[model samples]
Target: MSNELYIEKNGAIATIVINRPQKKNAFTLAMFKELGALLDELETDKNVKVLVVRGVDETAFSAGADISEFLEVRFSAEKAKKYNDFALESIEKLYRFSKPTIALIQGLAIGGGLELASSCDFRFAAENSKLGITAANIGIVYNLTSTKRLYNLIGLSKTKELLYTAKLISANEGKEIGLIDYVYSSEEIEEKCFEFAKQIIQKSSVAISGMKKVIQSVVDGENEESEAISEIILASYCSDDYKEGIQAFMEKRKPNF
Candidate 1:
């Protein structure tokens, strides 16, 4: 409902922009609710084939939680949990989103910002971007889900090194360490993201959606050969999208999936 988290749709692509440039797009408690609501809507929106989460400008993806609110809103453990619940809702929604999701990082994706990017299926960073998990610097422990996501990206040793040092790494270094997927020049990052999205949008949405779940299951340490995985595979094979894919290959033309 608030403009802090707003959606802009172009055809089947939906971009959720964090609008708090004055604070480098740092998220507030209310903004998290708005983001969660948007994610909920997009999750069930069949028309949305791809989703991109980005900051309002090239200044930053997000600087993490607004600590300014801590004194008034999260001073106690009870209040802290409630504050965390809002963030967890939004982050988990993004992490478990069925469709393809991308975090287009520009500059200063630190602390919770890095965690947010880790939740996406892909992270595309601008060449000038800086990324790190800064909770340790402030004497706070990262949440389990966020820790798991970060661990999945950079592994145990690097995760330790990152949390211990709380140092910012360049976009290229982030990509090398598996924290980010791709990096482009600052001026070209947004355009490159759309180009990447176009490649995904041309595929079979049903197949992609199914695979995303299966892959996430594996990432979560679920058995890939389990009955649930089989069911998902069977459903995809039985889908019209599968037939279209086969037919298009035989016909030697592009598939309109």
Candidate 2:
């Protein structure tokens, strides 16, 4: 994996840090490729129960794609298409990740940055964080998948307003509009993120994974009565975690999940 995108595992929680503080963690094409590869590995790594994505510092979650590389790397239609495809693959992986995912946003989360945050299952932003999708300002259309994710999170009206205006909203506004799940002061954001992750890790992994799959299916418009959904429900019922949970409740003890 590229140094720009590194992972730090702490027991059940794996934190993916976007390390480009000098550039406000702006993603390069290589960074996208690395992220896609890392997600592939983490998805199969049963030890990682929760994933948190964040920038290395409090300055910015990400300034989005590095525009300085535009002329050299994305000046031509063919090149731009390839570049976008790389990012799309990475974003899709994050969106479809089976494990619980969270985005810890601190400062600026604009354009692609906002897209990255939206890909996660939950977004927790610092009170002063600024988030927006600014592709409209640069005369480029946002990717369809990212747009759909944003629309799903904040609804059609708010999504349209953000895209059309290209204005960054405060973290509080983001929470109000459903772009973020929670907001904390900048100093407390990281600590609060870990606290949230701890709560998630304490849950049964089997149930969490099953829930993630079923939720994704529903979001994709699959009916709850589908056979695939039923199969997942059945598997969860048969899992050891389920029995353990029942035993713990009866015994009045915390379950070791």
Candidate 3:
């Protein structure tokens, strides 16, 4: 993995830190590739039940994609499409991750960074943090997947306001607009994020994963199929963990599975 992204594991919780503090943790092509790899690892790593993503420094969750690299990489239309594709793959992995995910926003979360946070299941931000989608400023059209994610979180009206204005909004404003789930002081952001993650970890992993998929299905308009719900129920019933859960409950003990 590139040094641009760092992974720290703490039992059931895993934190992925964007390490390019000098560039406000802006993601480069290399960082995007590393992020995809990291997600792949986390998916199969049963020990990691919840994932938290944050920038290395409190200065910015990320200022967005590294524009410095974009100059050379996005010079041509074809190249720009390829570059965007790389980022799309990484972001989509996070969007569709089976486990519960959280975005810990400390500072500026702009452009693609804002999109990354939107992909997560929940976002927690420092009171001083700023969030915005700035694709309009760069003359790029937001893709369908990204637009859907943002619109789903904040609704079309608010999503358009942010995209059209390209203005940074306060953390509190973000929460009010439903962009972030909670806002805390800078001093308390990290503590609050961990506490949130701990609470999430206490829940059943199977149930969480199932709910994640079902929610996505609903958002994607696939939940109308009765088979979708049935599949989740059937999978849960046949899971070894489910059996263990029942045995544990009958035995009056915590599940060890």
TM-score of 2: 0.97
How does each model score on TM-score?
0.97, 0.97, 0.94
Cα distance off (Å), candidate 1, residue 30: 0.8
* 13-127: candidate 3 lDDT, tens digit per residue: 9999999888899988888888999999999998999999999889899998998887798878999999989999999999899999999999999988998899899999999
| Clashes in predicted model 1 | 0
Error of 2 at 227 (Å): 2.4
Q: Order the numbered candidates by TM-score, best leading.
A: 2, 1, 3
What TM-score does prediction 3 earn? 0.94
Deviation (Å) of 43 in candidate 2: 0.9
- Evaluate model 2: give its lDDT: 0.92
- The sequence of per-residue lDDT tens digits that candidate 2 reaches over residues 1-257 is 56899999999999999999999999988898999999999999999999999999898999899998989888898999999999999999999999999999999999888888999999999998999989888889887888888988999999999999999899999999999999999889889999999999999999998888888888999875588778989988899999999999999999989
| Candidate 2: worst-modelled 10 consecutive residues by lDDT | 222-231
Which has the higher TM-score value, candidate number 1 or candidate number 3?
1
lDDT of 2 at 235: 88
Query: Candidate 3: deviation at residue 239, Å?
Result: 2.8
